[model samples]
Target: MSDAERQRRIAEAAYHKARERGFQGDRHLDDWLEAERELDRQEPRRP
Candidate 1:
């Protein structure tokens, strides 16, 4: 799968996991998701 698609799945899983654990604050999730994307971008791609 493409990087973007992988990121989307990761974000979705994070969201559901947070919800299951009773996490509050929309900003918290957003910040985590944004950080994940940034990290992904910074990582070197495999051949």
Candidate 2:
């Protein structure tokens, strides 16, 4: 998958996991999601 797609899936998974654990604030979820995306963006992809 492309970087954007990979990041999106990772963020979505994390968001759902947090929600399942009772994370209710939009700000917290958004911040976590953005952090995941940023981390993925910084990583080098393997061929």
Candidate No. with top TM-score: 2
- Pairs that collide, model 2: none
Q: What is the C-alpha lDDT profile of model 2 across 1-47, one tens digit per residue?
A: 68888767767767776677688665666656666766568764669
Give candidate 2's whole-model lDDT: 0.69
The 10-residue segment of model 2 with minimum total lDDT is: 24-33
Q: How many backbone clashes does candidate 1 have?
A: 0
Report the poorest 10 consecutive residues by lDDT, candidate 1.
38-47
Write the residue-wise lDDT of candidate 1 on 1-47 in tens digits. 57887677667767765776588666666756765766568664566
User: How high is the lDDT of residue 5 in model 1?
Assistant: 72
Which residue pairs collide, candidate 1?
A: none
Tell me each candidate's TM-score: 0.50, 0.52
| Residue 36, candidate 2: C-alpha displacement in angstroms | 8.5
The per-model lDDT (C-alpha) reads 0.67, 0.69
